[model samples]
Target chain A: MTTRVLVAKVGLDGHDRGIKVVARILRDAGMEVVYTGLFQTPEMVAVAAIQEDVDVVGLSMLSGAHLTLAPLVVAALRERGSDIPVVVGGIVPGNDVEDLTAAGVAAIFGPGASAEEIVTAITTLVPQGH
Target chain B: MTDNPYKTWREAFDAAPTRDADFTTLSGIPLEPVYGPEEGEFPGAYPYTRGIHASMYRSKLWTMRMFAGFGTAVDTNARFREIIAAGGTGLSTAFDMPTLLGLDSDDPMSLGEVGRCGVAIDSLADVRDLFAGIDLSRITTSMTINSPAAVMLALFVAQAEERGVKRSALGGTLQNDILKEYQAQKEFVFPPRQSMRLVRDTMAFTAAEMPKWNSISVSGYHIREAGSTAAEELAFTLANGFAYVELAREAGLTIDDVAPRLSFFFNAHIDFFEEIAKYRAARRVWATWTRGHYGAEDPRSWQLRFHTQTAGVSLTAQQPEVNIARTAIEALAGVLGGTQSLHTNSMDEAIALPTARAARIALRTQQVLAYETNVAHVADPLGGSWFVEELTSEVERQAEEILAEILDKGRGSMLEGCIAGIEENWFQGRIADSAYALEKTFNAGRRIVVGVNAFTEGNEEEDLAILRITNADEKKQVERLAAVRQARHAARVEAALATLKRQAADPTINLMPALIDAAKAEATVGEMMGAMVTVFGRHVEVPSL
Candidate 1:
């Protein structure tokens, strides 16, 4: 089985550099990558993740809205009866990272996290479960 | 041979050599060991390759305009006072994410974003609180806004009027360069043509009424952040600036009237000399185009005065304190390269919003460069350097090529060309390619960013004091917005919005007066923008190649 990942940018934030980079890395890692482009709502991301049956969902935010957006994404995934692990990356503060982790985000990639680390973390978390 | 005398040194160098190849700037501009007059033109002269002003900082230091905003208007107002009190010269305002996107704090879209990134201002009341104790006439302000720049400017003018300050007395630069938003920042609200119309309306109105206010700050800061090469930043920014000039002329404003009010904003990145050369090249290119192409007679129209913020994209979360050194170097480049104003990034920006202490440190970084470094004592100190001049020429050559390409796309009309290119996603695609290339280099260890790639410290992020906006702040902001909505006369707000919608529908009418009226009626930012969106419709990029 190959790993399947969904990359989504929630809300009105348009900082897509990090998310786009991650999508490329996942695709290069031989995973099936589905990119939800900018200005996506929580429900949109949730529906796409469920429909794609992704093993993991990755969210990227640079606007400091992870505290609000991450939980909504997690809850949306749950409401759709999906158990896909969630990972996030961007300029998220440490406190927010803790909060996001507590809110069921499986992993957080900060500014210095390498593509290898992110890919490894995803592979470890999902383990080719798609 | 004469080289036989130094044969031993050469042999040693060959054995333990440099890592790879010859040194070059981040933009891949080849540098020389020395610079001379053979490189280009002189400072404070036509085709200003050196300095725009002959004396440069010797006559007056560049303005220490730090971008301060966060939490409520009152909070940012207090921060502004603190910055002024700490020997800062001018003010630059940063709006919250919600406000930047033209949403009111009470809107569902604005739920968790209020007061997170910058100060939240939903109405003129918030603007009034933002400048509560400060005298508008005493200090100049530069707002980092687009899409709704006219609304923000109107709010400023209305607040100034409440303070009995004449509209002409206020001074500031509006980041009304929406073309760059489509290219880089991606904080766009309306379609390209409609947004350009709004920009043109503001330019025409400001040219007539607000003589001291800069109607547009043609920006390259976001372009650089969006992963463009230095030359690409220069080319795209100047292309957009020319498009605006063309757009204003199409709207029937003379070049002399609106040209002087057009300012620029740039990014002072980690490459010290390249950043300096980028500024020098920018001045030369603008002067050449404005005088030769637009036939501008005024020196102000030919001069390229810009405000620079040290690159936030260059900062790293690992060993965040090292960012202080990075900022100092970048700020020095802005000074040496001749900027009108500078903002150094806070050390903690890579992690979160700067705490007050971090903000002060950022300001002190500028002060140290201005007063202690003594680099400002001479005008274009590196004017005749072989390396600097060569880099400057290379930047100019590359930028002019891009500019020519953009103009060619316009089919003789730069504005049309910009519109066509934006709709075709040319600029966005170019930036994305550049960004991808840089990321590849970084990931492959070809480019060594100090704390990120080269000098790897394992999980070095310690206890960092990052600014956090609590849930209480959001609740308070929402309630305040609710109270404002309840307090303002509903009929007046509706009437003002209706007039805005009417004006928006009619391209013949300038929308500034109606926007100002809407601001005065206490209409929220979202309401005014919502009305316009209803008239002009909203826009979203496809982001596909």
Candidate 2:
């Protein structure tokens, strides 16, 4: 099966250039990328990820709310009996990377993460059985 | 023709003393020792193709308004003082995303976002704390708030009242441009027409009451940051400005009375010559439109004064320190283009909120340009350059074409046209398309980003320490909001909000007085904006891309 990824913008941050670019990148990389538009709450994202049945979910946040909001998205998926890992990206500080990983975020892509690296990370998140 | 007055000067320049050094650039393109045809309209004249002022920086340096706000009121207040003490001329406040969207700190939507991107302002109490020690009367402050900018302005006026500062004595700007919100920033709350009402109300209020305050910093900074070309940034900003002028005319304000106080905000992107050309074209377009189209009599009304912020999008995540060089080059472009004020992005802006040390260096970048370098001695110093003049005219032509397209959509009403465009994702579609194309170019290695593509020699690990604003600030901000709510008289707040809602529904009444009354009652930004929301429903964007 082809890799499926759910891309979303959680919370009130509206810097969508990176997310939009990454969405196109994933699509170009031969992956089915479902993008849930802006102002999505964690619950909405989790529900969308589950409904889409994607292999991984990507959250783009630049409002410095990643630490508080990203983990909640991860937990929201688990609460819904879904283990769909959420990948995070944006202006994330270096120190918070580990905390985000420990919170079950599959991967973190900072500002300069190349298209190849992002595609690889999403690809690796896909299970072979899928 | 007429002996070509420049012939003598050209011949003298050709026979001028030649240096032994090669005039060719590193790329091997030969450069003329001197450029000719250095004749054009002077600065401070009609059309303002050169600088808006005759002397430009020779008379007064561009105000350095460093945008620094994060965490609680007290936290941001300290940073404000640091900026002030560091010789920053003006204060520019950056509200948190929640604050920008007009949500209370305790609102569920504002969770994890309070004081994150900027300061968390809830009520007048928070504003009081935010500007506690800062002199409201003497210092000019620019608040980067929109969607709920009228509410923010009301809160500002109420705070100024508390400080016993006369409303007319106030000097500052409100980023009250809402058209770009739908087009780019996406920080909008109410629908377009309703938001225009709020903007018109604020413009009318400032026109009548505050002489020094710029009612709207009609902005293209966010538009360019959202990946618009420099020309698009100029044209969109000017078109929106013209829209506001139309709205003001309908609101019974004279063009001259309102136009002089209407300033602009633009982005100085990394396309150095192109960015400079964009500014020159912007002034020419705005001046021509205000005079020829709007029939403004005052020269100040024709002059376009703008604040330039170095493009934040151009900063790189790889070899973050390299951003300083980019910022310096960009700032030089802004200065050369005759910006009225400037904000240099910090080296670590791509990673996080600027560290104090990093912000100081950014400020120093401006200081170096102003004091150390002699770039400011002449106004519109690059005006006569053959290349610059050509680029300016070309950018203006492109911008004017798009602007005309938008104008036709509203039957010449920019406000209506903007609303129509927002309804159908016209601006959004174009912006998204441009962004996608640029990303493709970068991805395909067609363009070179120093650290990201061409020269990737930096460490994988980012070692630069960044300023962190944790949820502790959120907790404190929420607690403060709660305390403000508890302390203020609830009945007064409700009554003021009711009046505000009543006034919002009425087309004849200006909403600023009611908004100011609500602010006086200690009504929160959410409550005031909530009242407007009740009158004008929320905006659900037409999803483009």
Candidate 3:
């Protein structure tokens, strides 16, 4: 069974270069991909993730709001009683990784994350629950 | 008679005040300043394939403009003073995401983004705080705002007027090119046709009133960063510019009046030769169109002046310090390409906002290139090189091809076609396809990005201490926004916005005066933009991946 993933830009940053590439990466790896468009608030993203019923949700935040916005996204998912794990990507500093992890973000991908690494992380996080 | 270019150059070389610098290679081998080219194709001549100016950087080095902004107006103001105090001639402002989107700091849509990406500005008070100590008359500013650019520029002029600076005394460039926002950047607010009206309004006002101002800096920088190829960036930007030229004619503005005040902004991407060729191709294409298509008589109308910024997408988070080397190479490419101004990317930008140390290094990169390197001593130094000439011509051909497609899409009207293309996702789909193709090659190990795919031994990202804006700053900005609302007279703001709304609905009225009135009444950027939005319903792009 193929895993499914939802990639979303969760804040005001309009930069979708990496996430677009990630969508193709997962698609080529035989995983289903859903890309929610830009400027999504946490609630909108959570609603989309739950409605889409994806195995994992990936949020791209390049506008340095990841520290403040990513955790809200995690809590937003929990608030709606969805345990779909979330991964935060883009320009995340090393020092903030612990806080993001503590906030229940499952994984973090920075600028240079490879396609194989991203696919592996997604597959491992969502375990064989197609 | 069309004389041979070499002989013409020879006669002019002897008659003109003999060039003052030593024309020699590093080993002191005597060398000619520049090789010959066609009479009509030389620098400062028709179609300006070489450069818009004859001397190029020999007389004036490209303005070393550094883009800096973060946190609040106070925070960005300190940085501006430092840039000007440190011998930097120009200041390029980077507004925070909320400000860029025309939201007040307290707007719910602006949560956590108030000061995250750049400075948080809500009112004319914020603008006053932004330029507190800096003399507005002396320093030139370039604002990177689009959707709300008219409001931002109005606020700026109001601030200058409060300081007793005449409107004519101001100098700056407004990134009023709304076409690219729909095509790439995705920061658009109104429908493309309505947005073009706002852009045209600014052009009409600035072309008449503010002689020193550049009304529309039709930009390809964001398009390139959003994954466009070099030729695509050039073609799309020039296409948007031509759309404005046509739109201006519709508004009763002449080509010569608006064209001279129009400028361009481009990206100096990682590919060295390709980036240089893109700039050369850009000048040729712009000059040819402005003359043949627009029927402009002023020579200034034919010259394409531009500012170049090193590509931010090329910077990597792994081994972040290596970006310094990359920025230097890209900056050198911009200089060689004859840019009118430049902004070099800071090394640590890929990881976070650039730390002060990282920003200093970026500025020093330009200083070294401008002063230490002798690349600027001669104009179009590579003019006659076979490889460069061929690449330049090829890039020109490719860009013209792309422009033709866009023109056909509009059915001969670029403005209409761009709006059609946006609705059809033509630009977004093409960019995504190109980006995916490159990603496929990298994933297949066919293309190597150092420190990522190759040279991975002992590679570690050094702790460059990236700049981070805290939520505390957000709270502070919100409080300031609250205070501003409480202080300003509600009646004044309401009346001003009422006028703006009425004028926005009537296409005949130039909205600049009304916008300036609203700003003078201390109306927040959001309220002013909201008024216009009500008149012109909001626009949302169709989702594309």
Candidate 4:
């Protein structure tokens, strides 16, 4: 079984280092990755995920706009009838991680997360057959 | 061999191998056992392992450039005055996102972003207002805008002209680095090739007219903040700088003609020694490349003068005040590393655009360092330190290897296809791995960041007032943009824009004159950018990973 992930940057956050790094790690780990460049709208991210048929959508946002952007991407994905899991990593505050989780984010990786852990999380969150 | 005084060095060391936990780089380069003169050379020489100039910060302190912008032009003008009044020696302008993206405030695309991040400038009128009472002759200003940098440059030139300031008398920097916008910032309007053309035009124009002005500030601040490793930041930025120099040369400007005006902007990350080494290595590499590779004879052309910004990524939202400490440490590294100018990040940066109070504190960080601290009393204070010199040499060596790898692929080929390839392979991948590794370390309790995964107690809600631009301010900005558009003569704007479009399509013609004409004719940023975008289509990054 192969894993496909769409790594995206949403909103005005121009920081792509985390997302770009994650995308590369996932690819090297034998998963297909799609990198959505900076300033992506939630709708664009969800559409890209659906069109690419990715297994999971990972969001990397450092800008304070994550409060508005993260939830919108999740909601947009669900509304588009894609039940793919979502993962987020960045400078998100500790208190807000739970908020992101409650918004249907499968997992939240903060500043200190490793690529192996993220790959493991995605592989575990979505079963092979699913 | 076993009976040697060191007990066969490895054998004796192996018996204990006292793992010096304190001696490792963020990238895991181990500290050497010892260093002699042969290990790394002296300061102010090739490889610049120690320092760029013989007397560094002791000769002149780093330029105290506070990043200032907010609300209307008048409001931001007042803030600039406040920063200057508060002992800032240089000025750095932060334009609102709309201006940065070449959109007028009234544009539908600019909704909710006008005057939020920085100041809003619609035309030369706004530029005039921005520098209304400010003297351009005495103090230098750095503008941090890229895509519409040529337009802003025109506006600036016109503003200075209005004040009877000769182009020759003007001094400052324009962050005319559009390539980074594509690679990191995403504020780019035209595609890469056309953006390079605009940069070439600006370089040619400034070289001829405004000799005192730094045409392009080749920036690695955004690249580092975007998550590049220190080595990646150093190599990629120099590569981009080399590309710009090549562009200027292709535009018929001599290497010496433009190299002196080329400045750099770097991010001073939390890795204190590593960041310091990065700066030293940067100057050495830039100087070497300018003199040896580009054959630049002028000493001024060989020097790498940069402005430093404390790493915004190092700041955490949990304990925002802790950022002040982080910024101070980073700023110190920059100062010791010998930056020409510096902009310290605000403590509240992780949460919002810095409030006035936060901005003041940020500025004061530099002030205290400049006056109160004895750190600036001597030049390149750490120039001869064994540890610093060793680290600087190691960084330069590693960075040179990376540069070789980048160039081995052929500079032109790399510029053509390797950019996307590298974005896929090394650039984005390495960033991901580092970010992931750091996260894993935190989660596993190996790495501890205060107020984060570990030492996570005593986090409390504090009553803090954040300065926010109201919807009313946004409304006023939009109205102002609309009024500027309405007031400008329609036919003149059209004709000027048409001329710009025609000139933009030609490789031989410099677009700066046409852009200046358009700016003077009161064509708003979006109108000019939109016109050029028509000639040069919008860039869409093709995802390779």
Model number with the top DockQ = 3
Candidate 2 C-alpha lDDT tens digits along A1-130: 8899888999999888888888888888998888898899999999999998899999998998899899999999999999998999898878889999999998999987889899998888887778
Error of 4 at B489 (Å): 1.3
Write down the TM-score of every candidate: 0.93, 0.93, 0.96, 0.83
lDDT measured at residue B295 in model 2 versus the true structure, 0 to 100:
91
Give me the displacement of residue A79 in model 3, in angstroms: 1.4
Q: In model 2, what are the clashing residue pairs, if there are any? A: none
Candidate 2 structure quality by residue, lDDT tens digits, B1-545: 22443453345334444433444545666654333344536666668887776546655789999998999889999999998899999889999998999899999999899988899999999899899989866668999999999999999999998889888888899999999999999998998888988899999999989989999999999988987887778888898898898999999888897999999999988899999999999999998888888899998999999999999999997888999999999999999999999999999899888989999999999999987666675567787888999999999999999899889998978777877887888888778778888988988899999988888877576578888877777898899888889999999999999999988889889999999999999999999988889889999885546
Q: For model 1, which pairs clash?
A: B34-B386, B35-B385, B35-B386, B36-B386, B410-B417
Residue range A40-72, candidate 4, lDDT tens digits: 788999999999998999998764446556788
Best by TM-score: 3
Model 4 lDDT per residue over B91-138, tens place: 889888778878788775555567767888888778888887877666
TM-score of 1: 0.93
**Candidate 3 pairs with clashing backbones:** B410-B417
Residue A96 local lDDT, model 3: 90
Which rank order by DockQ, best down to worst?
Answer: 3, 2, 1, 4
User: After superposition, which runs of candidate 4 have C-alpha atoms over 4 Å from their true positions?
Assistant: A1-7, A20-35, A46-130, B1-55, B411-426
Q: Each candidate's lDDT (Cα)? A: 0.85, 0.87, 0.87, 0.77
